[model samples]
Target: MQDHIVVLTGAGISAESGLSTFRDNGGLWEQHSVYDVATPEAFARNQELVLRFYNDRRRQLASAQPNRAHQLLAELEQRYRVTVVTQNVDDLHERGGASNVIHLHGELTKARSSKYPELVYDIGYRDINPGDTCDRGAQLRPHIVWFGEEVPMLDKAAEVVRTADHLLIVGTSLQVYPAAGLVYEVDRDVPITVIDPGEPASVSRARFIRKGAVEGVAEWVAHYL
Candidate 1:
């Protein structure tokens, strides 16, 4: 049986494929304040603004393609039991052919009912307007784990990490909590590799590949695997 290989990804990986992080280049996401579009208070004050912001993000996601790092990870699944736990809201991993993926930051291609969060719908290239409603007749909102919301998948992700024979982390700064803390969940004896251009925050023993996502992941995989 192949050893379970759990990989955790963040903005850096997707940024290689043209996806920008909310904190990139001086702490701003898409030239707008993160508070204006990503907070529940912002949504309450101006739903239209919030909806349009995500709509724009959705359009950008539609335009971007999976990069080398994404493709390589997909190929790794051929050799290992791969499970991708990503903080990206985009569907790049799925598009890149990663079969098992968990989105910690929710997804861009989905919308849920305001009344019932479970009533989510797959929205492909469609705009979520103000009047969009579910069976309960409540407005629809982006299926995203916005600021201040609890990540429902944290426990499951922790369990996955705890059992991994190898842990591969790519493109994240290890600054964000909950998701960032997950690295500690892996068995200390299990080997861990982190690939990134900038030096990511670390807890002793992680082998760091200091390079961009594509180059770093490829190099690390070649040297170690």
Candidate 2:
């Protein structure tokens, strides 16, 4: 049986593909504070503004392409049992050919019924208007797990991390809660590698490759693949 290789990725990997990071522009996303557009309260205060914000992001994602780092991880599936656990809402990993991925933060390509979270619909890159409703006649909202919301996939992600024979962390600062804590779930004996341009806190024992995702992943591939 092939060794299980679990990869944890973040916004920094997608930043190379021209997507904006959450911390960019003085913590403002597209000139709007995260509190103004990324919370359920914000959505309640101004549904149109929230909808427009995500619509813009969806349009941007439509133009973005998967970078080399995404491709490299997918390529690793040929030799290892690869499972990607990503904090990013983008679909680049899937588009790059990764067969198994767990989106910790939800997806931009889908919408869920505000009244029934289980009623999710795949909407592709299309803009969701104020009147968009699910079959149950409830307002449709972005499938994204907004700030102040629970990360439903956290437990499953931890389970995957615990089974990893090899753990790779790329492009995250390891500053976010729940997701950051996942690194500790891997067995102490498992080989761990972190690829990022900046120093991510909390994983002192993991081998560090201080380069951007594309370059760092390439280096890891050369050594391990």
Candidate 3:
């Protein structure tokens, strides 16, 4: 049986591909908080604003290419059963040759009906305008797991982690809750490895690679070759 390798990725992984984090916008707009743009309350306040925000993000994602870390993980599928659980909403993993990927925060390339979340459609890199509606006649919202929204795939991710023979954590600070808890869910005997430039907040079991995601994952995977 092929060893199951589960990789947990965060914004750091996508950052290497030039994906911008919401850390600072330099007051270019109205100085809206990240929560102001990512929460249900925000969407309720301005539907067009929310839709436009996601539309731009989807477009930006379309222009990004998956980095070395992403492609290497895909190659690992040949040697072991690989499952990628990423906090990123971009589709770069699939484009980078990874066969199986779980988007913990949902996907930017999809939209769903406001009345029925199950009625999701792959919108690709298209903009999701306020006028877009589902079959139910409700406005289409980004399929993202927004702030204060439940992460629908949390349980599924934990289940995948529980089965891992080897675990790799990349580009995450382990500050995000629930997803961060996945580290504790792995079997005690399972070996864990973490690759990040900064010191991770809390990952006691894994061996550390103090480098950027692409360089770190590449270095670590090389040892196995």
- Residue 172 CA displacement from its true place in model 1, Å: 0.2
Better of 2 and 3 by TM-score: 2
| Each model's lDDT | 0.89, 0.94, 0.88
| Model 3 agreement with the true structure over 1-225: per-residue lDDT tens digits | 999999999988888998876532442134556656788898889888888888888878988999999999999988999999999899989999999999999999899998899999999999988778999899899999988999999999999999999999998888888789999999999999999888687677679999998999899889855
Task: State the lDDT at 212 in candidate 2.
Answer: 97
> How accurate locally is residue 37 in candidate 2, as Cα lDDT from 0 to 100?
92
Query: Candidates ranked by TM-score, best first?
Result: 2, 1, 3
**Candidate order (lDDT):** 2, 1, 3
Which residue pairs show backbone clashes in model 3?
Answer: none
Deviation (Å) of 176 in candidate 2: 0.4
Candidate 1 vs candidate 3, lDDT winner: 1
lDDT of model number 1:
0.89
* Tens digit per residue, CA lDDT, model 1, 1-225: 898888999999988888767777843475887788898888898999999988988998999999988988888887889999999999999999899998998999999987798999999757898999988899999999988888988999999999899899999999999899999998879989898888789757988889999999889778756
Pairs with steric clashes in candidate 1: none
Highest lDDT: give the candidate number.
2
TM-score, predicted candidate 1 vs. hidden true structure:
0.96
lDDT of 1 at 203: 56
Candidate 2: residue pairs that collide: none
